[model samples]
Target: MAETSITSPHIMQIVGYKNTGKSTLIAALTRSLTFAGRKVAVIKHDGHDHFEMDHEGTDSYSFAQAGADAVVVMSEKRTALIERQAIPLEDMIKYLSRYDWILIEGYKQAPYPKLVMVREEKDLSLMETLQDAVGIVSWLEHDKSESMKDSEGLVRHSVHEAEDIARWLVSLECHEEKRRL
Candidate 1:
């Protein structure tokens, strides 16, 4: 592992199976945070073998083809980095430390405070398997779903409760700042 050259940022993740509203929650959170004048960086964990972030004609891709090991392309609008191999979440977190908050989309096994999105009680089983879960986001607000108790201290929120979730993340950022000092 490469030595981490940056401080650990406030990190959280939304974890769930396909069609579980993970993307929805992430979008809402991003909008809310940006509106509140906070810089938020998101890292999506793609579990497919053919996840591509660069096109063949791009300079970054051309550099990679030339065995540069890592390629970085910077323009007035943005910068992109491409590496030869996958990077672990630990290192990615450091690389993104400049942001006020970092939200990950997958990596259920990652040991971070997680919000589990579920379609029904059956999917609640994932809570038991995850490394950590602080909250649950559900689209179903029926009595049956509410009756399904989550892990102790796990707060339940509706999928549309983006404002509430964003506030919670703000609180988390404050807490993380104290921890680093």
Candidate 2:
């Protein structure tokens, strides 16, 4: 049998501490990007040893309990899969490369183009620990503050301003596309 595939890693990540609006920002960005005709794939970190897609007693979960290696639930509108395996981030990223943009929600330590979210004084130093940071999204009351002054050399955007962030990400994907060509 022949396998088919398509992937274009216009990859970027949104990293930050818990409750820092990473998920909110990603949801807004995904809505905006998809509305603008871009295919965006998102992978979220569960921050645990196990991740569950279906609730117990559901048909899919029952299949897994029966020792099925994979369970796929599909409807005319959408499809989801619950599988058992461990794949490295690099391999997973490559597997999902068949999209115009790949936006990651965690794995802060991974080396990739990132939009690091900063929300508190203590999180200020978190940015410095990130790799390949393209921009910082500030969730502070004021966009500029003494605490954030040390975060030099990265573009800053307000967390509440989701459209602006989405626009910036779209441009990043375009820039990467040119570089890839």
Cα distance off (Å), candidate 2, residue 91: 2.5
Evaluate model 2: give its TM-score.
0.86
131-171: candidate 1 lDDT, tens digit per residue: 77888888877587855563678888888898999988777
lDDT of 1 at 59: 72
> Top lDDT: which candidate number?
1
Model 2 per-residue lDDT tens digits across residues 2-25: 111233557779999989999999
Regions of model 1 farther than 4 Å from truth: 1-7, 178-181
- Taking all chains together, each candidate's TM-score versus the true structure is 0.87, 0.86
lDDT of 1: 0.82
